[model samples]
Target: MQKISTCLWFENQAEEAAKFYVSVFGDSRILDVSRFGEGGPGQAGQVITVEFEIEGRKFMALNGGAPANFTEAVSFVVDCSDQAEVDRYWSALTDGGAESMCGWLKDRYGVSWQIVPSVLGSLIGGPDPEGAQRAMQAMLGMQKLDIAALQTAYDG
Candidate 1:
């Protein structure tokens, strides 16, 4: 059992969101589900929470039954090794979502996610200040990160 897992508050999309997330990531599955009992706050047999794990991180989707709006203040970051990986995640996550500045995006469920490349850190924090700034500039203009473009900026 992992300690300190994340819990997502939802109006009523606990099961749906958990299943969607499980399908999106590899090495992930539904862990457990707790349902409402008779004469409860929710309908009997309705899912109260759906626990799941994605890439080793555990998450609980809760049917809090309120207007659960997610903000960009907290977001999950998906680090990709290359353009293909980045594109894959971007496509899946942004299918019904909106794109934001840089690599930030709001998924269909209103969850913010940052799909970034693994090399972004090095490119934007390299020893060469000019190169780093160039990389940062390149990243600022990109919705989906392009490793080649960032590398070119850093190399310049």
Candidate 2:
């Protein structure tokens, strides 16, 4: 059991969200699921919480009541090794959600996710400030990050 875990509040789609997330990340799985009992906050037999993992990081999805206040203040950043990995997650996550610039997307549950390429971090953390600036500029205009394009900008 991890000492710290991220908990997500949902209207009633915790199980669905957990399955969706586990399907997206190859190195992830659904650990456990707890159902609401009689007289609980949620309907009996309904999923109350779902424990899942994405690339080894544990997270819990809570099927709480109607969302009163949930926003994109915090998000998960996925560092993909290639464009294929990015595309896989981007497509699955943005299917019933919205897409934002610079590899940002909101899942159906209103969770913001940054599907970044591993190389992007390298470019941004490069020794040459000019190269990093160019890469950053290129990233700013992109909705889905293209690893090749970022490399071109960084090498320019």
Candidate 3:
């Protein structure tokens, strides 16, 4: 068990969100689910919390009433090895969500995610300052990151 895990507050879709997240990431699964009991705050049998794992990271989703809305201030970063991985995560996460600049997105449930290519760091922070700046410029214009484009910019 991890010492600390992320707990997402949801209005009433903790279980549904957990299931959706499990489907999106590889090596992910639902670990446990707690439901409301009789005389509880919510209706009996309704899900109260869901514990899930994504790529070995633990998370909990709670069906708290009037959940605090998620903002870009806090986002989960998904490091991608290549463009395909970035594309896949972008599609899955942005299905019903909004897109922001530079590989940032909000999932259908309003959770913020950063589906970034692993090379982004070296490209934008490489020894070649000019090349890195160019790569940064290219990245600024893109929504879902394109590894090829970033590489080209870095090479140029």
Candidate 4:
């Protein structure tokens, strides 16, 4: 059992969201689900919380009603090893979602995510300041990160 894990708040969609997440991530599954009891905040037997894992990382989802919502302040970052990996996650996550600049997107559930190449850190933090700046500039203009373009800017 993990000592600590992330929890997502939803409006009576914890089960749906957890299932969707499990389907999206190849290595994921639902661990457990707890339902509301009699006289609880929610209707009896209603889904209250769900426990799941994504790529080995455990996450909990709470059906805390419609009050709580997701925002851009907190986002999950998917570090992709290659363009193919980046495309896979980007396409799946943005299917019914909106795309934002700099490899950011808001999923149908309003959760923000960043699908970026693992090399981004290296290119933007390299010793060459000018190259790093170019890479940064290239990333700023991209919705979904382009590894080739970033490399070109880094090498320019």
The C-alpha TM-scores of every prediction are: 0.97, 0.90, 0.97, 0.94
Sequence-dependent TM-score of model 1: 0.97
Decide which is better by TM-score, 2 or 3. Answer: 3
Better of 2 and 3 by lDDT: 3
Root-mean-square deviation of each candidate, in angstroms?
Answer: 0.9, 1.6, 0.8, 1.3
lDDT of each: 0.94, 0.89, 0.94, 0.93
Error of 3 at 17 (Å): 0.3
User: Taking the tens digit of each residue's C-alpha lDDT, what string does model 4 give over 1-156?
Assistant: 779899999988899999988988888999999998998877899999999999999999999876687899999999899999999989888888899999999988889999989999989888899999999999999999999999999999
- Across 1-156, the per-residue lDDT of candidate 1 in tens digits comes to 787999999999899999989998899999999998998888999999999999999999999998779999999999898899999999999988898878999999999999999999999999999999999999999998889999999999
Candidate 2 ranges beyond 4 A from true positions: none
Scored against the true structure, residue 96 in model 1 reaches a CA lDDT of 87
Q: What is the lDDT of residue 30 in candidate 4?
A: 99
Task: Give the range of the ten consecutive residues with the poorest summed lDDT in model 1.
Answer: 93-102
Deviation of model 2 at 19, angstroms:
1.1
Top-scoring candidate (lDDT): 3
| lDDT, residue 116, candidate 2 | 92
Tens-digit lDDT track for model 3 on 1-156?
699989999999999999999999999999999998999888999999999999999999999988689999999999999888999999999999989999999999999999999999999999999999999999999998999999999999
